[model samples]
Target: MSLANLSRIARAEGDPKVLQTGRSSLPTADRVARSLGWFSIALGLTELFAPGAIARTLGLDGRKGLVRAYGAREIGAGVVSLSTERSLGLWSRVAGDALDLATLAPALGRDNPKRRAAALAFTLVAGVALIDVVAAGSATAVHARAPNRRRNYRDRSGFPQGVAAARGAAAALRAHDDLATARRLPAGSEAKAPAVG
Candidate 1:
């Protein structure tokens, strides 16, 4: 079935039907940031569940705990990126990239057999860091309000004639209803009947 038809499965009776769909209005930076967020979560789950493998590959044999901690951090950043705070999340990923680079630096030494792997990991992270920086900046620019701008709504009102006039008209209608009810009741029955206003 088509996506529109599939969407109808969860809708209740009387709910508005989807006639069509179109492209998302999300900015390019935001779209990239969202993809990065999912990437972060996936990487985090891997690191969290297999920290030993990551540490060994990076020549950090005894630092499985630290790798696991980084995994958790990735997951948190990913969640924030996918949320309304996309810029914040992208910036966080940039910071995490710095940490990853620092952690991998020692593994690039000649003594470590996995130095080649660590170097490759560092290069990959640096590239991702560049992307994160660009996405963060773009997203921030796209969502920011104009400087020194202020909204003015003093001239607008729901009632065309003004609030006081609307209130007066409502009061008059209530009074007319009360008078008509009184006339329809038997004399001295006003106290027995419920109030109209």
Candidate 2:
């Protein structure tokens, strides 16, 4: 019923070759997530500080306010992605991209002189959104498959059993030292150590 026993059972049911030998120390997938997070933060900062430039580039000339609002959303998504698990954060980015494309749809009107620019921007956003979707799915799969092997009190390498293990090891070393010391004495010597009552 304990968590450790459950983990053991799960391991027993699975292929031995599939068992993870040790903890992940910076999984490549996680690193990709973090990189995306930094990218989000950078893009967010650019949008927030230069809404007018972004509006001009995307051919949303008079929609600086809308662009700035989107920037705020970007900043929020960036923070979430960087501070937590990648799945949620990347999904948020995907949602943000959808909103971005929706907002740009009007700029693609036939009468719009900057329609081509808007289309290019939309294409770029769509591509990024695809990446976000893939990354989110990957992150989700990684998270789900990852074992919950938290260092808990019951585990020997964890904190709870620390004192007991240390004490046992120390006692073993002390016994070995005492035997060695006794053997070093003269062959006929009767060493009488004092015992405190």
Candidate 3:
């Protein structure tokens, strides 16, 4: 449900539907995703540096679930950031940052298995955090120069270019027909001219 998580997933697992369409994802969308990614990573890092900080920010009890979730998020972000197709480093950073924060959370107080605070977890979190940081930074850089992903026009409402062109051509034909009729008209046949004009 989290944007950071989703971005991570997308980077890891290709969304065939998105790719098949051959349209670029919007820059605004990229920006949002990238921002979320950074936020997640930063949250993790903040918790890591000072577990008390996370508790202070989210109330003391809120820090409990962060440990496991941090691991999940960092791993997720790393996968996403590593993705060759997307390489959404920014989103990865958020995920990694979240890991850093989570690992740091349990360290704030007396360690317990319930906290399940492990050095390995912290290390993994740290590794991913590094990756995410780089990724997130790269994403920011890309965003600055990132080109808008253009989508092909969908003609679902009956206004496809070909259709419109045909309609225009028909109208032109009709106008020509009217001009031919006028040319064919005899001067005395002005009486037969339609009054609609």
Candidate 4:
């Protein structure tokens, strides 16, 4: 069976059916943010699992713990990016990229044997940082609310009748319920009845 058919099998009778599937309706910036989130998670896993390898490759000797810490940070940012708070996550990633650059700068020293690798890593991080900045700005702009916009809900009362009428109906319903409860009780239950406000 098709994917939609499979989904339909699990749905209730009155649930809306899926007619077809297509590209996501998310905005371009949001899509980018999502992609970055996945990237962050993958990279974080790598760093978390192989901090020693990463430290050796970058010539940041004895910093395995730090690399692991950064990995945790990446995973946290990734989770946020994949959630409704994409802008916040992207901004956090930009901050992380700055930290990565600072940490890698020391690895570029003349005495470091992996200076070239460090430079390459630094360049890649800088590029990703630029993308993060762009994605964050775009996402923020796309999700920002208009300052002067005001919502008009003058015609809505959330009930078929007006508010006052709805309140009166609710009181009548409550009174009816109380009467029904009284009828369901034993003869002397009124003496032990709970007080109502």
Ranking by lDDT: 4, 1, 2, 3
**Worst ten-residue run, lDDT, model 3?**
168-177
Cα displacement (angstroms), candidate 2, residue 122, comes to 0.6
Top-scoring candidate (TM-score): 4
Mark the regions of model 4 whose C-alpha exceeds 4 Å error after superposition: 1-23, 154-170, 179-197
Steric clashes per prediction: 0, 0, 17, 0
lDDT of each: 0.88, 0.76, 0.51, 0.90
For each candidate, give its TM-score against the true structure. Answer: 0.76, 0.60, 0.30, 0.76
Model 2 lDDT tens row, 1-197: 55555566557555443333467676666777788888888888888889999888767788888877888888878877776656788889999999998998898998778799999988989999988888888877877854886656554564455666655432323332477775675533332433222
lDDT of 1: 0.88
Please identify which of the two predictions, 2 or 3, would achieve the higher lDDT against the true structure: 2
Task: Tell me the tens digit of each residue's lDDT in model 4 across 85-196.
Answer: 9999999999999999999999999999999999999999999999999999999999999889989999888987778776644332333256777466665554454443
Count of backbone collisions in candidate 3: 17
Candidate 1, residues 1-197: lDDT per residue as tens digits? Answer: 78878888789878988677778798888899899999999999999999999998889999999999999999999999999999999999999999999989989999999999999999999999999999999999999999998999998888999988876443323333566764565545544544454
Q: Which candidate comes out best when scored by lDDT?
A: 4
Global lDDT of model 4: 0.90
Off by over 4 Å in 2: 1-24, 145-197
Q: Which of the predicted structures, 2 or 3, would earn the higher TM-score when compared with the native?
A: 2
Q: For model 2, give the RMSD to the true fold.
A: 13.5
